[model samples]
Target: MTDNKQPASNVEDPAMPEDVTKESSQQHIAKDNAKTLKIRKVTNIILLVVCGLFVFHLIADRFIPITDLGRVRGFVVPITPQVSGEVIEISVIPNTLVQEGDVLAKINPIDYEIALQTAQQNVTQAGQNMGALSANVTASEAKVTSAKASLKNAQVQSKRIFAMADKGVMSQADADNARAELSSAEAGVASAQADLAKSKERLGSEGENNTNVKSALLALEQAKINLERTHIIAPTSGVAANFRLKEGVYAVAGQPIMTFISSEDVWIEASYRENSLGNMKAGDDVEFALDFAPGKVFKGKVAFIDYGIDWGQNEQSGKLAQASGQTGWLRQSQRFPVTITFDKEIAKGFKRVGGQADVIVYTDDSSIVNVFGKLWIRLISWLSYVR
Candidate 1:
């Protein structure tokens, strides 16, 4: 009774009770638990969505392969001269279209013309020499015939003279003279035969078959070819690019003076991950969007797939094979190139070589993944406008 009256601070207030404080703490904990549960549920939903997307991509990539690493490719032909000469005329303008056999340039044809004339004259002289050789051969044949007749007559005369001398009807001097004449006739025939062989050797076969005549004809033909080559013509239908040729410029043979981008053969080269090409094959349908022409999709078909890449190639440097070191836990996938040919002609102005593009291929016609691929490529086409 005395302590209660003395210490008012020791007494508990009705408004601040222990049970009430305990109840308030419990309420706060329940609210925190509810909030934590809600956060956990949201986190689970996000993880599930991400996993589902990853799985869908894996499945879709197999049937509908896509690649943003695509480029427009065309046959790049080097415009080079076959004969070195001063460029006298440039017939084509830079970045202009040309047809096959169109004159691209003209070299100094004066030297070639002179050479052609010289070749013609040489051919004529060869013909004259061949005719002379034929005449010599005929003359030698006639001489041989005459010598043979003389030899036969001398033989008969020598035999008659020897018989007369043996019967004492003719002098020994007469027999000796006849023998000398026979020997002379035989020498003449041998000389004529040797001359004939020499003439035949010089003449070879008659007419164009003669070695000298054939050589002259070949030289004339080569001169004509060189003269024609002076007028450089386009090898194929293409657009002339990187033109550096000008009048009076010394053009060297086998050196590229300009670049020719062939319009006849244009394709897309798409690089795809190695794992995504299992079902991909030539003749698959393809859709591509060029960076140059935004918001437009082009139709194409798979032309071919590259079988090999330059990586891991033996450079033949006579060194140890360099093992590429990888640091990460997951190795990076290798990419291979796939060629896609266009289904129709592209506008001549839009056909740029080495242009960028986004490409997708449909390996299966009935695959649902193709629907997504089609949508994705169109999306890429529209997106290209902003990029």
Candidate 2:
């Protein structure tokens, strides 16, 4: 009875605690498996989404090409003076609009004017000299004709006197005198002819065709042209930019004094990756945004695609081709310029040459790609504000 009563604490089963510990470990393992499975599923989903986006971008890039490397371009003309002189007047203000043929500035025309006047006088004098030469030629011809007639008479008289002397019908002295007269007439004729030929040589061609007259006329024309060039007329309808010319400033011939940007020839130049230009062609629809006018998208069309680039172009130097090495795994893509012309007039005062821009071309009518391009360009336009 004593032993059974004392063993109450030891009566419990020893395997029960071990079983409980084993069950707890099993529960932890099950929980860990569940968590790992969940994490795997999440990672797979993320990777799938990323791959899908990459594929979509590739397809969009092929059909709907886009580029942030764009610029507004126009006829950027250098306002150079054709005549060198002191600037006497500036008719147009800096950055002001001017019409074609409008005078932008004036060079001192005094020297050119005096040159023109002198040229005119030279032309007049040449004409007068030509008239005198013609008269001299005519007088020489008349003298030659009179001498030839006298020579004919003298030849007949000499022949008659010689026949009479041979027949003994006239004195030998008379015959000798006749022969002397004939010789004198022949000499006169020869001198007159020489004078005529010399006069003709001096006259050259007649009237305006004369060499001296033509030279004078050319000088006069050049003088007139030089005088006209003193007035610097606008080459095209555009704005006179950076007009720093002032009165009394010396302007050198062919040296640019200012800049002229043509308004009518405004366009956009976009540089796209070479792979992106495969399907693009002229007349393709285009959308562009300029940094100067943020949040505004303008419509345009593809004017042309440049056929060549300067990169990797070697001049005609006789040397081995220099090939560049690529150290990185991925090679850089070459870019080409595509010209875009506006479909309509751009907003006034917004067109500026060399302005940064973004552009996109719609190569096909694929609604999905086009819609995405439209949205993407608009988004870029809005982002331009922050940029």
Model 1, 17-98: lDDT tens digits are: 8889999999999999999999999999999999998999898889988899999889898988998899999899888889
Best by TM-score: 1
Worst 10 residues of 2 by lDDT: 343-352
Task: Please report how far candidate 1 places residue 4 from its true position, in Å.
Answer: 40
Tell me the TM-score of each prediction against the true structure: 0.85, 0.83
Top lDDT model: 2
Tens-digit lDDT track for model 2 on 47-143?
Answer: 9999998998898888899999998889989989888999999999878778899999999999999999999999999999999999999999999
Positional deviation of residue 5's Cα in model 1 after best superposition, in angstroms: 40
Backbone steric clashes in candidate 2, count: 0
Question: Cα RMSD (Å) per model?
Answer: 6.7, 5.9
> What is the alpha-carbon lDDT for the whole of candidate 1?
0.90
The TM-score measured for candidate 2 stands at 0.83
